[model samples]
Target: MIPTSKPHNPNFSSGPCSKRPGYELTQLDISTLGRSHRSDIGKSALQQAIEQTKSLLKIPADYKVGIVPASDTGAMEMMLWSLLGKKPVDVCYWESFGKGWFSDIKNQLQLSDVNPLTADYGQLPDLTLTNPDHDIVFTWNGTTSGVKVANADWISEQRSGLTICDATSAVFAMPMDWEKLDVTTFSWQKVLGGEGAHGMIILSPAAVERLESYTPPWPLPKIFRLTQNSKLIEGIFTGATINTPSMLCVADYLDALNWITEIGGVDAAIARSENNLAILTNFVNQHEWINFLAERVEQRSNTSVCLRLSLTDKQLKEFGQLLADQQVAYDINSYKDAPSGLRIWCGATVEAANVELLLPWLSWAYESVKNSD
Candidate 1:
C-alpha cells in the first residue's frame, strides 16, 4: 500500500538543507542588497551575523568568529594550510570528508610526521590513541557515515597541541564542548539551512596565540592567511571578510538566525533535531529490515542520520527513486563514498511531523522495490 501522507518538504539533502518552516524569501530584509560589502551597512550586517552566532552557540568571550570563503571545505583548507606544518599532527578520519582532510595533510601538504588514524564508514577511530602533545584534526560529526564523536571527553584538557574540528553538521544542533576545541569550522548551509558559499571559523585564544607565534613552512594563500607579520588580523572576526560575500545569502542567514532565536535559541533547535531523529528511531526499532549505519548508539548523529536498508544496491537506488517519484522524500540516498543506504537530514530546520510522515513512506518504498525485483 502506498503511504497516503508525505513529508511537507521533501528536501532531505544533507547540505543546503531545508529552510526553516514558514520561511519566505519576501520576509528577508533586502536593505543591504545594492550596498557594497565594504560599506558600513554591509559590514554591520556581517558583524551582526557573527555576534548572533557567538551568542547562540555560547562561544567564549575570547574566541574569534569570522565569516570566510568557499563554505566549510574552504575554511577547513585554510586552517590546514595555515596551521599544520608547525607541529607533528594526528589526523583521524571515518568518512569521506575526514578522509579528504587526512589526504590533504599526508599527500598534498606532504607532511612527513603525519599520523593517520582511520576507521570504516560506520565506525569511529580510536580517539584515545590521540597524543595530547600532537596537533589533532578530525570532524565532530561524520556526515556521510552517520557517526559522530559522543563527547569531548576523549580530548585532553591539558594538551599542548591544538584541536582543529570540522564541525559542519554538528554545530547548532549539537551541544559543543568549546573549551576543548582550539579551532572549529562550519558553514551556513548545514543545520541552519541557510544558503551556501560562506563558512564560519571559531578560534579559541590558544589558536590565536599559535597564529601569532608560528607560521607554516609553506606559502599561505591570501585567502588562507590569518595573520600578517606574526600579528592576528582582527578585522576578519569583526566582519571585514577576506573576500566579497553574497549579501542575499547574508540576509537569508540572518533570517534563519533570527528564527533560531525566536524558537528558544540553540537549546530549542537541538531538541527539534533530536525529536526528528527520535521519530526515525521509533520506526527503525519496530522494523527489522532497516537499521542505523552508526554502530554505537551514542555515536549516532542526530543531524545527518544514515540508515542501511535490507535491499540490494540496485534496489536501494530504486527505493529512493520511488520515494522521490511520490514526493515522499528527496535526496535521501547515501553519500557516493558511503555504503548503499539512505541519509536523512534530521537537522534543526526539519520538522518532526515531516519525519513521522517520511517513516511509513520508507516501508512502502522498500516493499515496492522489493516486490518489483
Candidate 2:
C-alpha cells in the first residue's frame, strides 16, 4: 500500500517531483469539480494559469503559450510534426529524450536527410556543428543524464532555421533565453509539481509562420494539429485545450503557479533549486563514496542532479538495493540508457532542508552497504 502519510522526509525522484507550500490533495474546492471544462469557471482558472506562467517566466508579450496535450512529449511532437517539413532537420542528442526524438525523426517521420549529432550521456553535442540553414532540435536540459546547456549564445539570432527546445526540466528552474528559442515545450508535472497530462508550448513569430505556411504530407492527428481553418489557433494558448482536459489537474497547476508567485517568481524559484543543488554538490564533494555523473560543473543540471557511487557494477547494484530498503527515495537509480548512478530532483518544490537530511542518509547507505559487501 502507498504510505498514508506524507514522508516526514524529502522526495528526490526526477519527475512528478515534490509539491509547493500550501499544497493539499484534499484542499481543492470540490464544488467546481463536476463542471464542464468549457464552463466559464474552468476557463477562467486555466487562463489565470497561462497568465501567471507568462508573468512568472517573463515570457515576451508576442509569444503564444498554449495548453497542449501529452505533457512535454505531446507538445514537442506537435511542434515536430507541424513544423519540421518546412526545412532540412538537424537534431542534437546528448541524453535519452534527445535519443527519443532522434528515433521519432528516423523511425516515425522516416526523414531521409535528418542529421543526428549525438554525444555520450553526461556530455553535450558540439553546438558549433549545428547548421543555421536546417531546423535544429535539442533539449535545454538532459533530465536523465543531469547535463544542461548553459547558454544559447551559440544559436544565431538571425538564423533562417527554426530552433526547437525541449525544456521540460529546465523551465522555472533556470533562466531561459527566450529570444534564442523559436519553439519551447514544458510539462506542468516537472518544475511546477503539478499533475501531468498537459503541456505548455510557446511559439515565436517564426514558429507561427512555419505552422501557417507549411503542412506535412503525413496525416495530422487532431491532438497534434495546431492549426484550424488554415489559421493557427491562438486561442489554444489561452486555456483552449485541443481536446478536453482534466479540470482538477488544471486547478492543481494553477495552485502550483500561484505558489511559485507567492515565493517570488522564477528567479527565486531558480535560486531555491540552485541552493538544493549546492547542498548536494557540497555533500558529494565531501563524500569520497559518491561523485556527480556530469563530467563538468558547467554541464551539471540544477533540477535533476545525477550522481554515481564509487563502486563496481555488481557492488553498485547491491548498494542501490540497500538504499531502497531504507525507503529514503524510490527510483533514484539512473535511467537505463544513462550510466549507472542516482538521479535526484532538485526542483523548486524540493526543500533544501530535506535534501540536506538526505545527504547524510546517502552517506549512511553507502557505508552500510560497503560494510555488508
Candidate 3:
C-alpha cells in the first residue's frame, strides 16, 4: 500500500542536507552582495560568523577559528601541510575521507614516519593504538560509513602530540571535547545546511604553537599559509580571510547560525539530530531486514545514518529511485565508495516528523522492489 502522506520537504542530500524549517531565501540579508569582501561590511559579517560560531560551540578564547576555501578538505589540507613533519604521525582511517587523508600523508606528502591504522567500512580503527608521542590524524565522524568516535576518551589528555580531526558532519550535531583536539575542521554545508566553498578550522593553543614553531619543507601556497615569517597570522582568525569569500554564502551561514541561536544553541541542535536518529532506530528495531552500517551503536552517526537493507545491489538502486520518484526522498543513496545501502541525512535541519514520515516510504519502497518480477 502506498503511504498517504509525504515529507513536506525532501531535500536530504548528506552534504548540503536540508535547510532549517521555515528557511526562506527572501529573509536573508543581502546588503553586502556586490561589496568587496575586504570592505568593512563584509569583514564585519565574517567576524560575526566567527564570533557566533565560537560562542555557540563554547570554543576557548585562546583557540582560533578561521574560514578557509574548498570546504572541509581545504582546511584539513592546510593543517596537514603546515603542522605535520615535526614528529611521527598516526593516520587512522575507516571511511573514504579518512582514507583520502591517509593517502595524502603517506603518498602525497611522502612523510617517512607515517603509520596507518585502518579498518574496513562499518568498523572503527583501533584508536587505542594511537601513541601519545605521535601526531594523530582521524575523522571524528565517518560520514560515508555512518560510524563515529563515541567520545574523546581514547585520546590521552597528557599526550604531547596534536590530535587533528575532520569533524565536518559531527560539529553541530555531536558533542566534541575541544581540549582533546588540537586541530578540527568542518564546513558550512554539513549540519548547518549552509552554502559550500567555505570551511571552518578550529585550532587549540597547542596547534598555534606548532604552526609558529615548525615550517614544512614543502612550498606553502598563499591560501594554505597560516604563518608569516614564523608569526601566526592574527587577522585570519579575526575575519581577514586569505581569499575572497562569497558574501551571499556568508549571509546564508549567518542565517543558519542565528537559527542555531534561536533553537537554544548546540545542545538543542544535537538533540534534534539525535531525535531524528531515534525515529529511524525505532523503525529499524521493528524490522528484521534492515540494519545499521555501523557495527556498534555507540559508533553510529546521528547525522549521516547509513543503513544496509536486505536487497540486491540492483534492488538497492531501484529502491532509492522509487523513493526519489515519489518525491519522498532525494540523494538518500549510499556514497559511491561505500557499500550499497541508504544514507539518510538525519541532521538538525531535518525535522523528526519528516523522518517519521520517511520510514513507511522506506518500507513501501523495499516491498515494491522485492515484489517486482
Candidate 4:
C-alpha cells in the first residue's frame, strides 16, 4: 500500500491534469447545487467562461469557440466527422493519439484517399513532405510520447488546406499561433484542472467557411452536427451548448481562467510549465538511471515530460511500483504502446517547489528498488 503522507509535494501525472494554484475541491461554488443549468444565472457564468477563454488565449475576434459534449476525444471526433472528407487529408502520426486519428480516418470514415505520414514514438513526421493542398491533422503535443511540434513555421502561410490541431495538452501551457491553426480542440481537465466531461473547439475563418460550404458524406448525430438549416450554428460558440452541461464544471473552469488571467494569461502559464520542466531536466541530467524519452531537447514537451529508466523492463516496472508505494504519484507509467517510462505533467498549476521536492524522492525510490533487486 502507498504511504498517505509526504511533504505536501506532488509528482506529475499526465491527465486528468494538474489543478490550479492553491486549488481546493471544497472551495468550489457549492451554491450552484439545486440550480438548473439553463437558468439565467448558470448561463451567465458559462458565458463568462467562454469569453474569458477567448481573451486569455488571445483568440482572434473572428474565430468561434464552443463547448462540446465529450472531452478532447469527442471534440476531435466532432471536427473530423464534420469537417473531413471535403478535401484530401494528410494525417500526421507520431504518438498514440495520432495513431487513433489514423484509425478513425481508415476504419471509421473509411476514406480511401487519405495520406498518412507517420514516425516512431519519439520523432515527428516530416512536415516538409506534407502537401499544402491537402487537409492536415496533427497534435500540437503528443501527450503519451512527450514529443511536440515546436511551431507552425513549417505550414505554408498561403496554403488552402485546413490545419487541424488536437491541442488538448498544449493549450494554455504553450503559445499557439492561432492564425496558422484552422481547427483547435482542448479539454477543461487539462491545463485548467477543471473537471472532465466537456471539450472546447475553436474554428478559424477558413474552418467556418468549410462548415458552411461543404457537407460530409457521413450522417452526423444531432450532437455532433454544427450546421443548422444550411447555416453554421454561430450561437453554439457563444456558450449555447448542444445539450445540458455541468454548471459546477463551468464554474470551476471560470475559476481556473480567472486564475490564469491574474497570472498574465497564456504566456505566464507557458513560462510556469517551462520552469517546472527545467526542474525535471536538471534532475535527469545528474541521474544516470533516467533520460528523457524525447530524442531531442527541441522535441521535448514542456507540459508532459516523458522519461525512460535506464534499466530492463522488469526493473523499470519494479522501480515504478516502489515510487507508488512511497505515495509520490499514481499512474506515472507511459502509454503501453510506447517504450516503458514515466510521463510527468508539468502544467501551470503544478507547483515548481513540489516538483523539486519530489525529485530526490524519485532518486531514493530508484536506488531502493535497485538495491532490493
Off by over 4 Å in 1: none
lDDT of 3 by residue, 139-214 (tens): 9999999999999999999999999999999999999999999999999999999999999999999999999999
List pairs with backbone clashes in candidate 2. Answer: 66-237
Runs of candidate 4 with Cα error greater than 4 angstroms are 1-7, 371-373
Which runs of model 2 end up more than 4 angstroms from their true locations? 1-7, 29-31, 371-373
TM-score per candidate, chains pooled: 0.99, 0.95, 0.99, 0.96
Model 1 C-alpha lDDT versus the unseen true structure: 0.94
Please, what is the whole-model Cα lDDT of each candidate in the order they appear?
Answer: 0.94, 0.85, 0.95, 0.86
Ranking by lDDT: 3, 1, 4, 2
lDDT of 2 by residue, 54-153 (tens): 8889999999888988999999998888888667899998989999998998789888879999888878888889998899999999999999998998
1-373: candidate 4 lDDT, tens digit per residue: 2323453645466888768878876877656656776677766776787888898999999999889998999999999999999788999989999999989988999988899999898888888788889899999999989999989998988889999999999999988999999999999998877789999999999999999998899899988999987698976877678888888888788889878988988999999999999999999999888999889898899988889886677777887787776677666778788888888788998988778767877777677666554
Q: Answer with 2 or 4, whichever has the higher TM-score.
A: 4
Q: Residue 355 in candidate 1 has what lDDT?
A: 90
Worst 10 residues of 3 by lDDT: 364-373
On a 0 to 100 scale, what is the lDDT of residue 129 in model 3?
97
Better of 3 and 4 by TM-score: 3
Q: Which ten residues in a row have the lowest lDDT in candidate 1?
A: 364-373
TM-score: model 3 vs. ground truth: 0.99
